[model samples]
Target: MSDRSGIFAGEDPFAIAQGWLSEAEKIEINDPNAIALASVDADGLPNVRMVLLKEIEAQSAPSGGAFVFYTNYGSAKGVEIEQAGKAAFVMHWKSLRRQIRVRGLTSREEGPQADAYYTSRSLKSRLGAWASDQSQPLASRTALMAEVAKVTATHGPNPKRPPFWGGIRITPLEIEFWADGAFRLHDRFRWRRPDPNSAWEILRLNP
Candidate 1:
């Protein structure tokens, strides 16, 4: 019947992703959750950067499933996401020799979930979030640290989440899992849907 076995065996793509991430957490030397997030600006020029994926919501989530990451809403990528309403990312684990690619709809997650994550950060990080004008040209390191000092003095130890910062969730229309194989041939399985509410159609692709 279906050849999807071992690491590729899972009914739900989101579940498969979470399981893979859990395994990576044990052996990945660094940030196992890092993703190369891709977005496009108003001009249609593409941009991509590495960002830590904060969470992977399961299929039971209200939005079905989503990959979440936080950043300054005023940042370039944030502005692009707001403009385009879509984004893509690839989470590659060099240690595990595997990767997950996703492309989908984007939305702001600025409610309680955002607040809780913001609150979980270290005090300096919280203050730094308030201080830094992300993706903007800065005068120098001195200027940045000066601003950090200023925000630290003003916001104190329990600085609240900055108004310009929160989570951005990408609800994928397509999710693909790929693993390294012997002899340069790779195993790939793509799960795609027409829209957020549609059921996924799975396909095994050529290497």
Candidate 2:
């Protein structure tokens, strides 16, 4: 990592990721924390969708750092992650012409942290989480809205975070950083380790 400098200079990949995202937030028009999450179904079919990245835990975290995002446990992405025990994602910033990619093991974060995050959301979002049986068929929009109304009635002003909805933390085994370069010769670096407990092996890859 002798050549690492500027945006890429950091002892922890999670810290570097946070710096890039912070920069993205200032220039991106919307959803600066959005990431294209990838997972596989029970049949091994691939699924990808955009999800907002919620937290990039620091290296000092008890789990040694991770990327966190929330979703319904019954959702397609959630079920896929549970079945396969792995996932990957990419976050790109068109304004900065840079992107970061990660692949890792997955686990649920449905505890006090999940409840705290759920509480921070708008009331409507909290109720919507209770109503939506994500990745499942719904007869019509009206039916869905009615269900939302019913849940709102039952839960009142302060509904508990649904057990079915919570966070997912990805403890990455590999992370790659790429930046656009002249004549399509992009600058690329990948940091990898066999597991979270091991030291990273950095490689500068040709692009």
Which candidate tops TM-score? 2
lDDT of 1: 0.95
How many clashing residue pairs are found in candidate 1? 0
* RMSD after CA superposition, every candidate: 0.8, 0.6
lDDT of 2: 0.95
Candidate 2: Cα lDDT at 118: 98
Q: What is the TM-score of each predicted model, taking all chains together?
A: 0.98, 0.99
Model 2 TM-score, all chains together? 0.99
After TM-score superposition, the amount by which residue 16's alpha carbon in candidate 1 deviates from its true location, in angstroms, is: 0.4
Which residue pairs collide in model 1, if any?
none
Please report, as a residue range, the 10-residue window in candidate 2 with the lowest summed lDDT.
1-10
User: Per-residue alpha-carbon lDDT of model 1 for 1-207, expressed as tens digits?
Assistant: 189999999788999999999999999999999999999999999999999999999999997999999999999999999999999999999999999999999999999999999999988889889999999999999999999999989888888888899999999999999999999799999999999999899999998
Predictions in order: lDDT: 0.95, 0.95
CA-RMSD of model 2: 0.6
Q: Write the per-residue lDDT of candidate 2 for residues 42-138, one digit (tens) a residue.
A: 8889999999999999989987999999999999999999999999999999999999999999999988989999999999999999999999999
What is the Cα-based lDDT of residue 191 in candidate 2?
Answer: 93
